[model samples]
Target chain A: MQIVREQDVVPFRNRVKEFATKIGMSLVNQTKLITAASELVRNMLKYANGGKILLEIISKNAQTGVRLTFIDEGPGITDIKQAMQDGFSTGKSLGLGLPGAKRLVNEFDLKSKPGEGTTVTVTHWKNGR
Target chain B: MDRIPILKMGQFLLVTIQVDLYDRLALNLENDLINMVSKTGARGVLIDISAVSIVDSFMGRILGNIASMSRIMDAETVVVGMQPAVAITLVELGLTLQGVYTALDVEKGMELLHDKIGTIEHPEDEEEEAPHDDID
Candidate 1:
């Protein structure tokens, strides 16, 4: 999915919700997944001007999880460590986008290169393992 | 181009967010709501968000901003009908919505507004005189 504007956020969230529901994720877990996705998508738009999101469902034995990867080709983060800290935003936002999204999911991974682009991948398990 | 309507009830402003608000719509609502409060001198502002399911950090900030702005303008803002899932997500997102009053439902929100601002005077009621025959 391509996220190029603010209007794209709602439809993307609805798609994620549908995917999560298909896997029988709980309401709370579904909300968390959708919220985390919202933060990451907004960040991509704000910093990178737009991005591509990949939604995948992974299974480990009998457990199932939803994974979302956000890829942006805009200006990459020079200091990922600082970016992960709470209240550390280059924009006028509250700076909870990155770290807050991490707290809501089971797994979080971020990769960025200066003068290149950024990629953020997150996963939420149905059973919250 | 989509806009959320802000309704005025007596001395209060009511906003029931019935759609999944995009960022622009949310921002527009914040701007329009403050203007309405300032223009009408409304004593209280009730926001019913029962239909909204997802509230990320941006949405959270908008709500907080509305409350703070309304307070400075002498209007109390109450956010009501937050879903349980949304509440949990908000707390985890580090947005506690400080200084913003909240209620479980619209009716309770109205009661809280009345409590905060005292008895409300309906503009329509003031147009007609109540029978004074029983008074003294």
Candidate 2:
């Protein structure tokens, strides 16, 4: 697990990019995955101070994909439904944070509590439509 | 203290980000670019991001802010040499960068800016007469 912070954004994206390239992912696909990762990591830093991410390569039914789980132990989200809305943001931004990241990948799972923490898991499948 | 240099061409300011842009650096660039646009009365601006590999929402917002700020200053902004991957990522992120213009390269970006603002009166025809070896 790699710690996610402000300075770690670029390096985290680079590591994800390398893994995507190694999996024979196209440049476009690689960018999408890395971009998604960038958003999640930044969220971890912004809302949770800093967190750790688990990177994994998974296979099922002769298919391969990359999975990332972001775990943060800060003040958790109160309303997951409203937070996933396209234009809702607690920070000074366009509020495309969670939804935008979700749009860039194949699978997304977000679990959070009021005071516990937040864990967001996302995946990108190779040649996934 | 790292600062990205903004070059003043005939009537346009050129900024080529050759290194990874950190949060502070990006914010600083925004402030500098806006100030430069106002002080120089530049009609157009071209930002080359060919060397940049990754762009997240923060970087996307910075670009958008720079373009918007330049527009308010009566200066047009053109982003040049965006990698195909970055472009794709941006689209997925739902950041169309609505007001900013984009080009395949600096030369084309310059030309686009010229088309938008038209040619201004200058003492010398440095644009056409100057050597074009720097555009790679």
The candidate that wins on DockQ is 1
Residues A1-129, candidate 2: write the lDDT tens digits: 566556777777778877787788877888888888888888888899988898888887888888899999989999999999987999887888899999999999999997889999999988854
Candidate 2, residues B83-134, lDDT tens digits: the string is 9889988888898988889999998998899879977444376666776677
Every candidate's DockQ is: 0.72, 0.65
Judging by TM-score against the true structure, name the best candidate: 1
True contacts kept of each: 0.96, 0.74
Residues B32-112, model 1: lDDT tens digits:
999999899998999999999999999999999999999999999999999999999999989899989999999999989
Candidates in order, TM-scores: namely 0.93, 0.89
lDDT of 2: 0.88
lDDT score at residue B45, model 1, on the 0-100 scale: 95
| Candidate 1 i-RMS | 0.6
Off by over 4 Å in 1: B120-136
TM-score (chain B only), all candidates:
0.86, 0.86
TM-score, model 2 to reference: 0.89
- State the lDDT at B16 in candidate 2: 94
What CAPRI grade goes to candidate 2? medium
